[model samples]
Target: MRKSAAPFLLALALPLAALAQAPVQYSLAFPNAVHHEARITVVFAEVPAAGPLQVRMARSSPGRYALHEFAKNVYDVQATDSKGQPLTVTRPDSYGWDVSGHDGTVRFTYTLFGDRTDGTYAGIDQRHAHLNMPATLAYARGLEQRPAEVKFELPTDWQVATQLRPDANGTYYAPHLQYLMDSPTSLGAQQRRTWQTLGRTIEMSVLHEGTAAELDAYVEQSKKVVQEAAAIFGGLPEYDFGRYTFVANYLPQTSSDGMEHRNSTSLTSNRPLRGAGALDNLGTVAHEFFHSWNVERIRPRDLEPFDFERANMSNSLWFAEGFTQYYGELLLRRAGIYTDEQYCQEALNGLVGAMLNSPGAARFSPVQMSQQAPFVDAAAAIDPNNRGNTYLSYYYIGGANALALDLELRQNHKTTLDAYMRAVWQQHGQTQRTYAPANPYTLTDLQRILGEVSKDTAFAGRFFRQHLLGHELPKFDQLLAPAGLLVRRAKAGQASLVARLSFNPADSTATVGSTLVGSPLYQAGLDREDVVRKIDGQRLTSAKALPELLAAHKPGDVLTVEYRTRGGIRTAPVTLAEDPTLEVVTYETARRPVTRAMKKFRAEWLSGKAKSFYPKPQPEDKDVSG
Candidate 1:
């Protein structure tokens, strides 16, 4: 028996080696790219002798809260066994196909029709194939924990751009299904720039119809953004494969969008790397890069295990997305892309104005508003809803709160939001397990960390209760005072209906787009689609007529208004009110005195926090690796 032990050991080792080599394999080929179609094949091997295997396309992509039903684009699906023999396949649901009699191995193939180029959908053309993984690939149900490998049979002279770790055999690897779904790939003739910082490789792959010189110049600008973003959190996150990627597609055929992933970002725009469009596009760069830390790593618990089966709802997007929105523009200022006056006028002014004037902010707290993301975060429907009147984007609400909280921390606690962010990174985002975050944060964790950073539990509790859970906004005028920024009424002493109106010259009627709640128009029972025939007995002949009528009156003045509703023409006595819009301007711009204290406050708040770490990128350092 001892002499024959070798044969027994060989039998056990055979299946172990087979299991080790059995990964969910996926191969993509664009045979009909001109028609926006890709042929995809997935191989599931060593299936543990399971009776049936369920394969399906993801319903929703990451960084999106809506259910997109990606299965709608998949067709011509077929399956086979290990020996290339036909397997019996049955449609169990709209999204999945069940395969039986697979002999412990199943090969699934399908055709994916994709036409849109954005962060949430797949786009294919003669020029390139932009693929969001969840939209392009299918996965086997019980094989989620197995390693996944992707091989792209690219077009001539085309290469792949993705965060997926690559092997010498031209195959990309993901630890598991979660990482596989989050990786988006861009296949094209890409121009890329690579650099090393903090012992990590950072790559920017741009697929555009631009010159090499233009890409080099844009790389310089983007370098500044990356450095400034890293400074806020002390350094770059420890990337899984010791690399991070920016997959950008700036072409006329692509849609404008920026989506965040764990180790990379998808930046797409219909703008080129020339003129004002370049800087405008860079704004999205700062935003999605910041998300690598905020939403991708310092994640909300509601989104920790992102579900691909249905709509993913979260109540902390105000902090996840809104705070990131705040830093998106702020980081530009710190990087010197925006002057102080420009930052105050554009970013600060917009945030304060929306929070001050929006009826949604007044009606819903940040938490409540964030819960509405599943309905409004790019969700589509034919019938209209009252989102215009009831929704204030969590981005603006959270940004305004960040502005206030940052000031409060600086003035009262002698700390900065930067410090609190570092604390959050250390506690929740710094530690990681290969593919996902190990300590993704929760709402309670955010409050607790704020308390720890500020050394004031009571202040943190009060702030969260008042601004986050309650619909109470901080006084922006007072918060901006120390920094010598002014928050004042834009149109003081002027009467306004405070509603957006579209004038139709054909009928000489003004259509009310959406009436702000609590505004004069809202008080007068005017809503969306109502046609205003006259104001103060004057015909609304053009866009200027309503402003002229408002100018002739003052706040608290009553005027006769005639309008058309679904019930027909109606008349009401409308009491006009002062325009509630707010604006932010530096004290210097406002012709107010800027003292030494104000200068110090502004410098501390706006200046760059870290030294430059990247060397000047050279044109010769271009990397075209897929």
Candidate 2:
């Protein structure tokens, strides 16, 4: 049985009176920003003078599922009262401080050190300060419903790019704690562009050393992506304030990342917006922007009212993130970024190949894989793990499933995934949401929607049971046939162990990385760290030797193998198997017949959807100020 959404709604139902209380105010100074440090102060007014007021940094940030323990970078903690007198501070837990003798008010201060520029962490330097709010700010526990206001004491000539509503005197406001934490800020010398579309404003603010012409060119391409994504949902989600921003930092110092927020997405990349890197960077933009509707609004029940104190777990990311992943690339094709079926076919090949061959996908369902985000989604650890054997990314699994469902719907139901997504948006996403999503969806809700969309409840039930909950892969070979695409073995006659080999030139030995569970090498008792000395009594001289040896033989051939392991040297007979890898190619490329129906299906599925709409006139570049 699933948990009811009633309790979650009740907990989030805030009274209008609580919002009038004095907000938690914060001031961020960067005297030591050149050295990667920020001095932050927060004041909690109207403290009840109860036992003690607790103030703490967040353990996790929005859109990130792992426990980052943001408090690790905080130091030199101190507290004071309204009159500048020091207060008694006690460490009640590792994440926060408790202050007494406050007289109904407590001012907390801390020095934070950060040097990484990405979506989940704070990166501060002389050039810029990239702040993900949860990584940079502290909040009082009981004041979650009160208003929040912050002012940035930025360096000279530096400006801010964020989704936070601008108030007078360089201050920004959020309705409550959740809204504040969901806003990310990029402070630097930024180049800005804005355009009006579908009765809303869309802006792209980029902080890069590139020329103005380059930024303009990037924005032109980004606009196509934005329009295509919006067309999928019928229109853009009513963004907070009727404006959406893309807060981007693309510099050599910035790490490659993209995070989705309510009104904006934090995009950071080290790649320059030129040549191949430009197209590569646009892929991230396509993915994150689609999240504006899929995840940011059509939210998951598990991730609603996100907890800042621990990891947020969700079972529906397969659809939330996965369907978005499928569309991220598909939309790129629809926007003319990818001009050929070959480029698009590569994406399908990779998705199908991994899901079909990976042991992890064979063992776990999409729901189980979605739950592994806490350990795999940008999570950090030192020890080695067997994730290769046990886990497949929800992105790939979900994307593959999306491809199947879309084709199935088109062929059998006389509809498309686009129509189903539009249904979901109208039902779950297009609600009247303010500080947070008012109508996050659950698994049960999705099944019902699928039933309604297809007009066949039995098909929806069977699809969910066999493909989502059951450990079974969709039949891609049959699904792709309708699109004039063929899924065939990449190397039909080749023999492979399917295990990675690291060769040592000098010693003429190859150390096995991780042997596939049931491959010939594994059946012969060879595993990771085992050294292969000779195959069929031929000493290995170079990395190419193994491939050359395998080329001479076909599947079902048996050969003697010699290898060294921790136990001792041994010899065994191994039975080779055909390479199970699959690849997708157009029928024309494969010299196969393509029917008229196939041609029509491919065109209808991939052609641009937003081209019929009249182009919106571009506005002049706006100079953004903090």
Quantify all predictions' global Cα lDDT against the true fold: 0.87, 0.87
Error of 2 at 381 (Å): 2.7
Q: For every model shown, what is its TM-score relative to the native structure?
A: 0.93, 0.94
TM-score leader? 2
lDDT of 1: 0.87
lDDT of 2: 0.87
- Stretches off by above 4 angstroms in model 2 are 1-14, 613-626
Backbone clashes, each candidate: 0, 0
Off by over 4 Å in 1: 1-21, 612-626
**Over the stretch 251-328, how does candidate 2's per-residue lDDT look in tens digits?**
899999999998999999999988777888888899999999888989998998788887889998899888998998
Candidate 1 per-residue C-alpha lDDT over 450-528 given as tens digits, one digit per residue, 9 for 90 to 100: 9999999999999999999999978988999999999888899999888889998998889998787788889999889
